[model samples]
Target: MSELAVPAPSRHQLALMIWLAVFPTLTVLNLLLGGWLGDLPVVLRTFVLATIAVPIVVYGIVPRLHRLRARVLRGPHG
Candidate 1:
């Protein structure tokens, strides 16, 4: 019998998707927050801050944790 194979998301692919998702949200938030200039609402300002913050956290923190988990569970090759 043949074994069934499943596709998985590569690190790069996952990163790209995350980046894709982050970008639009950030852009909207950026526009909402005056797009790096002019006056804007407080809620929009907060959203803008969140947009910047979420990417940094994802790029820096989430990936690091994933790497650690991969190393422990699946070894460094992953």
Candidate 2:
């Protein structure tokens, strides 16, 4: 049997990637929902934010970041 050739990121790297993806997503969500969500209980607000942020982070931002990882890592010093 042939193995697939995909390279998996380490646990630390995956955490970093998720952090990068979630930060901006959560920021935007907070900005958009702040007024409406502010009155809600902390747990409920967090749940709503997570619900909206997860899909966007997983399906949208994370993939784009992975695709651009090399260039992003190169930075201005490169």
Question: What lDDT tens digits, residue by residue, belong to model 1 across residues 4-64?
Answer: 3324458886776577656666666567655464566778667657867697667765566
For model 2, the stretches where C-alpha displacement exceeds 4 angstroms are 1-6, 70-78
C-alpha positional error of residue 11 in candidate 1 after TM-score superposition, expressed in Å: 0.1
Deviation (Å) of 36 in candidate 2: 0.7
Q: How many backbone clashes does candidate 1 have?
A: 0
TM-scores of all candidate predictions against the true structure: 0.39, 0.76
For residues 1-78, what per-residue lDDT tens digits would candidate 2 score against the true structure?
A: 543343566789889999999998999899999999999999999999999999999899989877666445655443
Worst 10 residues of 1 by lDDT: 1-10
Residues forming the 10-long window of minimal summed lDDT in candidate 2:
1-10
lDDT scores for all predictions? Answer: 0.61, 0.83
State which candidate has the highest TM-score. 2
